[model samples]
Target: AENARLRAREAGSLAELEAMVAAFDGCALKRTAKQLAFADGNPEADIMLVGEAPGAEEDRAGRPFVGRAGQLLDRMLASIGLDRSRVYIANVVPWRPPGNRTPTPQEVAICLPFTLRQIELCAPRFLVTLGAPATQTLLGLKEGIKRTRGRWVEYPGLVRPARALPMLHPAYLLRQPIDKRLAWRDLRLLRRALDEEPPR
Candidate 1:
């Protein structure tokens, strides 16, 4: 954990951070994973969306959100007049845990510094955490996504704070199609916020 903090703190830019995460072997997930599933989308975007971890397709593609869930996410973003070109996307755990298993707490702990640093470097106006793990991890929220989704919270950014919104993960929504209505409401909230933010 100490090593992660030190390495993450040393990253001067997003490129530097990616390089550091690629080289750092602190997390065991790195060993089993094929490659780093870093971030995708415009780094200069006003909105940044973060998910729990990479899935098989994302891991293989070395990019965040590239599978069925990713396709759904893209559609969700489009529903609000946003897309990959307009927003940044990343995952809490860059590597795909073997068989897509949930990352252990220790793994999340070690990798969190890098995730936090990624957000700091991006410095987006809005931080959207998808699913329970990301919302809980980034926002320090204790409640589940069902309870926290759509509510605005403050993200304690290292550079500057951003308005954080928790939302249901696309994968979860895929399993429970009816819950997409909730996601739609959250999307509307985000669109409203974006419309109100005035051009950067």
Candidate 2:
């Protein structure tokens, strides 16, 4: 795994990192997954969204955020006057897990480097981790999404530092429509962040 991480660190761009991930065979989840759902949206966007893993639709389409959750995500972005074209989107685990179950810690560890490399390459000004897994994985927080969502946390160890925000996954909102209001609040926070000038 360290070898993979080193290769990932050496990747010159998101495209190269993605190619590495696609060719990676360390994680068992990749074997069960239909395809690699690397990412979607503009790679140069200032805001990057990261989710846990792909669902059935995403696995089939080979693109992140393309299911019902994706439709809701589109609306969520629209609410903040943003869209896929304006923000880059990827997942902590590029490959889908069996039965859409959460990726185990071991699986996550194996795949973390690739995602980290992707983040380093994109160098987005702000990052939004959708759901507790992504939030914990990227932000290094043990707290649940409900506790961390809407709050700002700085993520270092990348090409550039970025302020990250945790938000409820669109899939969660789909299951709990009542929580869309809370998600809306987080979206507003993201909008404000986007409006602010980047630090010197």
- For each predicted model, how many residue pairs clash, with residues at least 3 apart or on different chains? 0, 0
**Model 1 segments more than 4 A misplaced:** none
lDDT of 1 by residue, 1-200 (tens): 89999889899999999999999999999999999999999999999999988989998999999999999999999998888999999999999999999888788889999999999999999999999889888998888889999999999774667999999999999999999999999999999999898856
Model 2 residue 193 CA deviation (Å) reads: 1.3
Q: What is the lDDT of residue 49 in candidate 2?
A: 97
Model 2: per-residue Cα lDDT at residue 24: 86
Model 2 C-alpha lDDT per residue in residues 5-70, reported as the tens digit of each score: 888988998888888888888989889999999999999998999998999999999999999999
Please report, as a residue range, the 10-residue window in candidate 1 with the lowest summed lDDT.
153-162
Q: lDDT: which candidate is best?
A: 1
Runs in model 2 deviating more than 4 A are: 198-200
Report lDDT (Cα) of residue 148, candidate 1.
92
TM-score of 2: 0.96
Clashing pairs in 2: none
